[model samples]
Target chain A: MQLRFLRVIFICLMSVAGMVSAAADLEINTPAITALKNSMQQRHNQLAPYYVSGAVGLTRDGQIVLRDANAVPLPQRQAVNALVGAENQDRSALYREIARANQHPEWESEIRSTFAGRWIEKAQPGWWVQDSQGGWKKK
Target chain B: MTKKSCIALAALLLAACVTINIYFPAAAAEKAADKIIDEVWQLKDGEAAGGKGDTGSTDDRPATKPGATK
Candidate 1:
């Protein structure tokens, strides 16, 4: 029947909409968030060389791990840890703020996982990044 | 019901059957992730600064979505 055909078309359209919604970008900007981003950006200057030298690597769960401790000079290891610790603090807040801003704290884990992949995906060649299976490889 | 109607009914039944799905909006999650990642690492000055943010631990990764099957 014509009615049955129309129903099928309707369902198909809805399914397409559902997929589109899933792919939509998420953004959460505010004064506090702006500050967090700025601070993290500023810290990158200090962290960049360490990443290049192979002292740290990006992890699969959106965190950092000391990839090769020897890459940092013996005395500088403590400073590097302090820096990573601070950077991670801000990063965590940034993720939480994003989820909260979206009005779905439940989405935090999903957001983090997505970032986990993107961080590795966007890594520069030779920088260590964890794979989906949790193996750290040079990108 | 006619044969055609019965076939249609069977197809509808298959479509309507229930199954557990932990809806992971992978597409949406990826988009959202990329946008944030780009912004956080958005510096064009070429910095390999991808690992810095840390708010809290859900150290427990959310469960992986189970494969689709009967």
Candidate 2:
């Protein structure tokens, strides 16, 4: 009876070891995600001028994701209008710019929240950013 | 102690360790941003140095040459 008990204990220990090993081998592909996140951030910075002039609009998979007009000057309203008009006509150029900036494949969903988080972190006083839930907040 | 009680105790201990939450580090995020931005700056520099030819390809003519008569 003692021998049988020892065998069962040994089997349970071996199963537990297997579970631990499996968990250890579970590698999260975080680097790719991080690279993509960083690329989006770089794109945001590259487009900062447009954003400040209320000229930048971003969408993911045909859904308007972010519409920002935080730093637009009152005197440059015409410029803003012109840019918006161009964007409304066709934002393909803007999307292409972002995709190139990130070195990411076209048609990949741009995770706007990741970029938003980065922007919020770097925003100067009184600048505005949209949160993950699309709520506007001042930084 | 009963065998069932011993097994339950071991399970409880394992669950405690497994349930620990890893907090997100803000410093890590900042570090990541700095590194990425530095890489971007290098890319821009390379483009400036003509390592990547024709930066003008992406420029929208209307935006760049504002004084052009229509």
Name the runs in model 1 displaced over 4 angstroms: A1-25, B1-25, B43-70
Q: Candidate 2 residues B1-70, lDDT tens each?
A: 4566556655654554444212222343344434444343332333323324335433333443758776
i-RMS values of the candidates, in order?
Answer: 5.7, 8.0
Q: Taking the tens digit of each residue's C-alpha lDDT, what string does model 1 give over A1-96?
A: 757665765675566565455336455557666788778767877888888887899999888877899888899999999988998888788778
Query: Relative to the unseen true structure, what is the C-alpha lDDT of residue A90 in candidate 2, on a scale of 0 to 100?
Result: 31
> How many residue pairs clash per model?
11, 0
lDDT of 1 at B33: 61
After superposition, candidate 2 runs with Cα above 4 Å error: A1-31, A57-118, A125-127, A131-139, B2-4, B21-70
The local distance difference test score of model 2 is 0.42
Mind giving the per-residue lDDT tens digits that candidate 2 earns over A47-136?
Answer: 556554434433322222225454555676566565445433333333334334444434223422333344355544454455556555
TM-score for each of the candidates: 0.62, 0.35
